[model samples]
Target: MLRGQRLGCLSIRKGGSVDTHVEAVLAELAALEDPRMRQVNERHGDDHGVNLTKLRGVAKARGTDHDLALRLWATDDTAARLVAILISRPKSFEASELDSMIREARAVKVHDWLVNYVVKKGPHAEELRVAWLDDPDPVVASAGWALTADVVAKRPELVDLPGLLRTIDAEMKAAPDREQWEMNSTLAAIGIHHPALRPQAIEIGERLEVLKDYPTPPGCTSPFAPIWIGEIVRRQSAG
Candidate 1:
């Protein structure tokens, strides 16, 4: 029998062990950490080296257990927290639940993963996105931008394109690093998806010089909005 362990406001029991299931998963994750992957992950500042494909397998084996997820998140292990996000119920975060997680989301991977795995799919996603846009916390604000960008990409007509363009024009260079990436991508999305705004987006791209000099990877479209838009426009014209 394993010893009892409980996070505030939540409890678990498995084979007479408190959170034993969570512990079991953690043990598995600890064994899977690869040194090379750890080195790469550390460079990215995420502090976890477990292969993602294997991690998913772990979640699959354990099945969906929000109780385990929450307890794993409460621990300090980076990989465990990632697994927590992976295993947790997609829309189970209650009011203020996200706020608590955001506080500890110091790593970029953690911030991005939580947003992708939890926040964007939740009922409060749109509300939280708009509200978090102006939040003081960089991570929250970054997440807000990311969520908005994704929505804008898929459904440009629903967002205030002009306002977003304005922000991209005015603040992207000065915004936080993650926020800049999101804003840049949003500008590209506008150019790619909204023909009427393509010129404006390209112009903004020119002014910002965002990715102007970025070396495009072989066979990959350049991330620079102007170049990316030009290529797409050329392809469309040819077609």
Candidate 2:
């Protein structure tokens, strides 16, 4: 059990028994628990954890604590779940399990980690992603777009740039906030990697004006697609 505002007193170890590793990780996280973070995490509906930075340190220690990670995820502790995503072996998951995780996920962090770290890197990423695009679940759909954005950025050869460009043009404004964000990224990726589609991407950005009104912190790129796409294209050109 967790001590008041402290992580559970479990003892985890790198390369140790899974039980030991889980315990040690929990104990370490418990020691680093921050009350202020818990208040913020609660807003995400059941994220149970300390700060992500500390959880990452725990994952680095284990590197690939598959069994330990599974056990941790079952605990529903926010920090433990994040560690689970980091250390779980991609090959160990079945397709059904991946779908189940998305359906069960209640926090955006879980959705992000599953898409960015787990599914996007899985062997069936493309296969799974294709179907996710049409999934009725918003989390799954958002993840599809997110995974697509990654594919568009790193493996453009695998994507149908023209088709995705059309999809972005059609669905972006009506999409949910998270899905719209990833959709914008897809637009940016298309602009950065596909020369023929770059102008079209810019046109889409101009039309949507998504994130145009959002404030940009000093020294940070604007999240607005027109601005974001411009910076990405500028970097690609400079290189």
Candidate 3:
């Protein structure tokens, strides 16, 4: 049977029951898949074929539905999980549950959305951040750095800027791609937000040369930390 036809066969019933809603959403997502979108997303290591804008529309229509979100996440479908993150109540998740979810979220977009939408807003963000920082798995460790970067950007007083720069100097160049990206982000965040440490952050970025030659499209900013830091600081000064 064709994939769409098979998905069409899912029993989507009316009313507010969790199973009914999940099946309905899955059906909606299956219908929204585009081959062109899949090709583009695959280039970025995301497996979903649904356009993110359309997926956000689906989530908007559903509003917040934590029970449905859990059911959708359990489906383990990338699009469904994205919708699940959209509809979830971040505070509703337990620390252990969030940790398990992050570890299981293998799709790049799924992991990204889960961290940005649910994990960051959850109360256990700091707890998970510290636990995952030195995790054996590089991907999990990347998430730890992502959370740490957020803290560095928003709550500088809570983190040790010099220590983070030292870690980035020591570890970023050799770290795996995902972890390295987040560590670089922390480096940029420190330089962008903390003038006192900006010089050291730029020095570390210059010394490492990570993403230095990254091909950035014309209008977008480069991910190289020194350039990223300089551009943002310039913008802040202009504003």
Candidate 4:
């Protein structure tokens, strides 16, 4: 069953046949934690073939072996492993383990696993992040801030948008300011997701001037801010 042919046997297109194959695949996948296999699965981009429900079952079968899941997942393509991790939601890992995975994975790729699964479900998400935000290490804090901003942009209601702007602003000000390019990149991501924050952000340009000088990267600029702001202002003036 290690070969691709066996995996094909595990594939079912529809109806009861699909259910049976999914069950078999989940069982096999749960038992097999070989990082090499995980890597091969990712290289082959077979994650799309996986049914989420079956992946959840496999994770459930694995029980509390979260570390095992992480190790196996680290070897796979980031996107596929992300889907697997979300399904598994494995618990009972040490704090160090999750933190290590977060740091490691964040650098390799800005995959959604950290935001969706780890931030949403992992036991140490809050604690680790709380510590991270105040970390003396700029690298750690910047990474934490970048991830936090990314997550918050998706669920703006989860945070006080104004407060976040201030927090990020304060951090940027207090830091040595060596990584202007990286900082702008992160800010651009925020702008893409939360148009409402743009006015406040654009205001920062008035004070720093550098913000205005920092032209948005070509082709990556978000229209959300311009569009939403225009509509709101237009309606207000009409009223």
Root-mean-square deviation of every model: 5.6, 6.9, 6.5, 12.0
Query: lDDT per residue, candidate 4, 103-198, as tens digits?
Result: 545322323345445654656555565556566655555545655655565655545667766755655544543223234434544554556766
lDDT of 4: 0.48
**Inter-residue clash pairs, candidate 1:** none
Candidate 3 per-residue C-alpha lDDT over 1-239 given as tens digits, one digit per residue, 9 for 90 to 100 = 00111111222332544466787888898999999999999998888899899999999999999977877877768899899899999999888788778787878989988889998998988988888898888988999999999999898777888998888999999999999999999999999999999999999999999999999999999999999999999999999
Error of 1 at 136 (Å): 1.9
TM-score of each: 0.85, 0.83, 0.91, 0.43
Model 2 vs. true fold: TM = 0.83
Sort the predicted structures by TM-score, highest score first. 3, 1, 2, 4
Clash counts for all predictions: 0, 12, 0, 0
Clashes of 4: 0
lDDT of each: 0.79, 0.77, 0.87, 0.48
After superposition, which runs of candidate 4 have C-alpha atoms over 4 Å from their true positions?
Answer: 1-68, 73-87, 90-94, 110-112, 150-164, 173-199, 205-220, 223-239
Give the Å shift of residue 77 in candidate 3: 0.5
Residue 195 in candidate 4, Cα distance off native in Å? 10
lDDT per residue (tens digit) for residues 1-239 in model 1 = 11123233333455567767666877899899899999998987889889989988987876788877888887757888888888888788763677667657877787888888898778867777777778887666887788887888775656899999998899987887777777787888889778999999999998899777777779988878898888877887899
Model 2, 144-229: lDDT tens digits are: 88888889878878778899988888889888887888888888878877788778888998998887888788999987877887
